[model samples]
Target: MTDAIRVTGLTKRFGARTVVDAVDLRVPEGRIMGFLGPNGSGKTTTIRMLCGLLTVDGGEGTVLGLDIRTAAAAIKRQAGYMTQRFSLYEDMTVGENLDFAARVQSVPGRRARVAEALDRMGLGGRRDQLAGHLSGGWKQRLALAATILHKPRLLLLDEPTAGVDPQARREFWDRIHGFAAEGMTVLVSTHYMDEAERCHAIAYIAYGKLLAAGSVAEVTAAAGLAAADVSGGDPELVRRIKALPSVETATAMGAQVHVAGADAAALAADLDRLAAEGLSWRPAPANLEDVFIHLMARRPDPAEAAR
Candidate 1:
């Protein structure tokens, strides 16, 4: 599969601070690539560079078969970007917002395009309602409709479902999948592990660096982490287990306690002792959350490093 986005040593600097250090990324055509990282980890910066919304201070890449450095204007015209926050005018009605977007994008048949977008997003009934009056979910839909008003081949979504409800998030993802099915490339930044798993592949960045990039199963397997879920363990037992030298993470999942570690042999020895205290455990597979947390721990924050 051809890479819809391919960059090598992609770098972005803000003044003296290198917000996006030398990083490389590749997203296959027509696939959703999840951008995962903690806040201020340069995910937004990397994405902006990919779509040519921001200038590349240093690096080389191609987006949509055009050079990123010189073809930014053309890239912007073809790519759709939805910011993390709702950016449409609140005073405008849904229909007005979409219509205005159509005009801004210079879309042909503005009226027809706006009507189609309204129906596509299921906002036909609320087209006349003020954008501010819509719920979070509806607001999300309006943003997406406006983003794709001109039918962009590349979609860059920055935490698009941050505060939306579960059902709404699911519905939004369904639409995303639909677009991908039709050969639209998507790169989305999200904090939700479930959302990351839905993507065809994921890239994890931290402290201006790209640490992990692969399919969910591949990334999870690369971490070399082991875990065990324990039942019949009290909250105090969880606390005691977490204090063990070999334990990396000990989290409670309702009635069960999940623990993971890098030193599997040591961890097993520790757990075996705890099992005598009425705790029952079976080796559990390492999951995305476990891998995500491990990656986060692997990188030290730049601020912390300076201090």
Candidate 2:
């Protein structure tokens, strides 16, 4: 089967500034593809280009089997996009907004579609409430309802869980899984590591570059970071270990110092020596956040992208 989304050498620029640089990506059908990057890393720009909301400056890709350059309108029609900000009318009631969306999408049985959306999002009882008066979580629910009202094949979510409470984020992810189980493909961009872990595949972009792409385990393994958990804050211990030639990252976390380096044996030996200095140590799995931060620090500053 054809991938849900496929692109190669995708690049977007504004004037002399390149926002998305020569990125390649593929998302298999019936899977959640997580897009991860720091702010201004061109994640949103790339997603927009894929969904055909914005034309690409230089690149070629197919979304939902449609040529991105020539069939953008068709791709847009087949995709449901939930942007980072709330774009619905605040003056309208919850049900009214959904009704407006269904009508705009020209969905058959518009009234029934609106009702279903309200129920699906658990906003049925608050249907008559003004959207402006709702909390961040409720507004998110409404936005989701509106976006999926047309039953699009592909869902593009840009930081959909931002500013939402933990419980609300959980509920939102549950809904996404439900959609994916039903054979719908989803591409979500998020800053949260938990959210990224929920995806079947993750792509990490930095400075408009595609840094890593794979299952969680695959990416972490590829990072080649050796980590040691050290308890008790010792300025001398940190300084001593950091001074070692092989140690790449030695930083404190709460009462513990997570020391990581490319050489497992070297990091281990350093920790063992620290134990002689009254420090407690244990082997720990290298965290994804650590790997990515290390990756970012190694990249050229994004400010240079505009040059």
lDDT of 2: 0.89
Q: Number of the top candidate by TM-score?
A: 1
Q: What is the model-wide C-alpha lDDT for candidate 1?
A: 0.92
Instruction: Provide the overall lDDT of each model, using Cα atoms, as 2-decimal numbers.
Output: 0.92, 0.89
Q: Per-residue lDDT for 1-307 in model 2, tens only?
A: 5698999999999898889999999999989999999998999999889888888889888899898888988887889999999989999999889988888888999988888888899999999999999999999999999999999999999999999999999999999999999999999999999998999999999989999999988999999898888887555667776788767777777777787777889878877777887778898888778788778868978576548
- Model 1 lDDT tens row, 57-86: 998989888899999888888889998889
The superposed Cα distance between candidate 1 and the true structure at residue 66, in angstroms, equals 1.3
* Alpha carbon deviation, residue 273, candidate 2 (Å): 2.7
After superposing candidate 1, which stretches have Cα over 4 Å from the reference?
none
Provide the lDDT at 36 for model 2. Answer: 95
* TM-score against truth, every candidate: 0.97, 0.94
Worst 10 residues of 2 by lDDT: 233-242
lDDT of 2 at 199: 95
